[model samples]
Target: MDLQAVVDSLPRYGEPLLTTIVVTVASAAFALVVAFALGLMTSSKHLAIRTPARAFVEFIRGSSAVVQLFWFAFAMPVLLGIQFDYLIAAGIIALGLNYGAYSSEVVRGAIAAVPKGQLEAATALNLTPLQKMRLVVLPQAWPEMIPSLCAFAIMLLKASALVSIIGVMDITALAGLIGSQAGQDRLVHYSVVLVMYFILAWLIWTGMRALERKAKRGLGVDVKPVKGRLAPEVAAGGVR
Candidate 1:
C-alpha cells in the first residue's frame, strides 16, 4: 500500500468533507420538518387533510432518489423557470423530500402507537384536539419516533453521495477523483474513503443515541446513564 498517497490526499479532502457534512445536516433538518408535517397531516381524522399528505409521502418514497435529484438539478430549472444558483440547495431538497417520505412513516406509526386510553383521558379532560395531541399523544409518540428517524437520517447521510452526480463536490466525488489518479494505489485510497464515511455515519449514530436517551428520559423511562456525560438531574442540582 502506498501510504504516502493516502497521507497526501488527506488534506485535499478538507473542503469536500465539509461539503458532504453540510449537505447531510441541511437535508436531515429539512427532512425532519417535512416528516412531522406530513406525518401529522396523514394522522388526521379528516380525509381531506390526510389524502394529499399520504399521496405525497407515497409518491416521493416510491420514486428513485437519483431520479428526484436529477429532476431538481436539470428538469426543475426548465420547468419551473427557477434556477437554483447553488446546486447544493437542489441536492439538499431532493434528499430531504425523498427521506422525509420514509421518515414520515416512522412519525405516523409512533403517533398511532399512543394508547387509545390517552386520547380518551384527554377528551374526558375537555382538552381541545390540538391540546390533546400536543400534551398527551405527542409526548408518548416522540420517543418512539427517534430511533427510526435516526436510521433514516443515517441513510440520508449515505445517500448524500448521490449529490456528487450533480457536481456538489462532496466526499465521494473527491474520493473517486483521487482513486482514478492513484492507479496502483487505488485500493488504499478507496479503503481510506470507506473509513471516512464510516466515521461520519458513526458520529451521526452517537448523536442520535444521545437524543434517544434524552427523549426516553422525558417519559420517566429508566435509561442507562451515558458515561463521561453529566446527567440532566445532576446538572440541575449542581455540585453537592
Candidate 2:
C-alpha cells in the first residue's frame, strides 16, 4: 500500500461523510414533524383522533427499520411503479417513520406533563383548542421535550449509517471503499470511521444543546453549565 495514496484518499471521504450529516438532519426534521403530529393526535381526547394516531405509531414502532429501509429503497419503487431517488426517499422516510414513532411517546409525555391548571387557564381565556396548544401548552412542553428530542436526534445520526446497506455512499460506505483500496490498512480506515461517527454525534449533541437553551429562554430559566455542557435539569425548571 502506498502511504501517500492512503493519505491522499482520506480527503475524498469528506464529501460522502457530509452526506451522512445531511441525511440525518433531513431525516430528523421529517421525523419531528411526524412525531409532533402523531403525538398530539394520540393525546387527543376523542377516539376518532387517538385511535388512528395510536395505530400508526404502533405499526411503525413494531416494524424493523432495516426492513423498512429496504422496502422503501429497494422494493417500493418497483412494487408501486413510482420513480424516485431511492437513496434519499428511502433513508428519509424510514428514519422519519421509525424514530418518529419512538419519539412520539416522548412528545406525548412532555405535552401531557404540562400543568393541568394551565389547561384550565386556557379554557377560561376562551382560547380554541388549536390556540391553546400553539400558544400555551407547546411553549411549556417544548422545554421538557428538548432533551428527549436531542437524544433521538443523536440516535438518528447513528442510524443513518444503515443507509450504506442500501447503496447510499455515506461515511460508512466510504470507509468500506477506502479499506478496499488500502488493503492491510483496513484497521486504520475503519478507525477513522469511528472518529467520524463520534464527531458527527457530538456535533448533533452540541446543536441540540443550543436549541435546548433557546427553548428554555421563554421559561426565564438560566442554565448553569455542568462539565462543559448545560444541565438539562437547570434548563428544564431549576431556576430559582
Candidate 3:
C-alpha cells in the first residue's frame, strides 16, 4: 500500500496491462460494428434477415463466454487446421462476439427510442428506407445511444479479464503472476489487484457519467435554466 510499492508493482504489470487495454479496445470496436449490423438486421422488415440475426444474438448471449473462448482457442485450430496465437485469436473471437450480442440489445433499444413522428416524416419526405435511416433516424438515435454504448464498452472492458483464462495474459493473469511471485503475500498481492480493478471500474463509471451529462445538455434537457424560468411562466399564467 506504500506509494513506492504500488509504483514498483505497476511496472511489473505494465506490459500486460497495455496488452489488456489494446485487446479490449480492438475487440470492443469490432463488437460495436458487428452489433450495429446484426441489430439492424434483427429489426429488419424481412423475416429472412431478422430471424437469423435474432437466433445468432440469442445463441451468443445464452452460452458461456468462457466456453466460447476455449472453443475458439483450442477447437478452432484443430477444426480449421490453422494456428493462431493464443492471445490474439481469443481476444478477437471471444470478446468481440460476446460484447457484440450485448451491443445488439443497446442498438435495438436505441432504434426503438427514435420517435415515430420522425419515421412518419421521413416517409412523407419520400426518403428511401436506407436514406431515412442514415440521414434522419441514426443521427437522432446516436445521442440517445451514447450512454448505453459507453456502459456496454465498460462491461466489455471488465469481461476482457476472462481472456486470461485462455492464456491471454491480461490484467487478471498478470495479477495472478504477481501474486504467485509474492508467495505467502499472495493475499496482499491479490488485494492490490482488487483495488486496481475497482479503480478501473470507477474510472469507467465516472467517464460514462460525464458523457451522460454532456449528452443531456446537448439534447437540451439540462434543467438549471428551465427551473429559473418556471416561476415567471407560472406567475404570468396566474397559477401561483
What's the distance in Å from true for residue 199, model 3? Answer: 3.0
The 10-residue segment of model 3 with minimum total lDDT is 179-188
The TM-scores, one per candidate, come to: 0.90, 0.90, 0.84
Inter-residue clash pairs, candidate 3: none
Sorting all predicted structures by TM-score, with the top scorer first, yields 1, 2, 3
Ten-residue segment with the worst summed lDDT in candidate 2? 222-231
Better by lDDT, candidate 3 or 1 = 1
Q: Candidate 1, clashing residue pairs?
A: none
RMSD of 1: 6.2
RMSD of each: 6.2, 4.7, 3.1
lDDT of each residue in 1-240, candidate 3, tens digit only: 354554577777777777767777788789989889988998788999999999999999999988888888887789987567655666677889988988898888888889999999999999999999998877767767777777788888788888888777877887777666533345666676677667776777787678767766766766245554566557689664
Residue 236, candidate 1: alpha-carbon lDDT:
84
| Higher-scoring candidate on TM-score, 1 or 2 | 1
Clashing pairs in 2: none
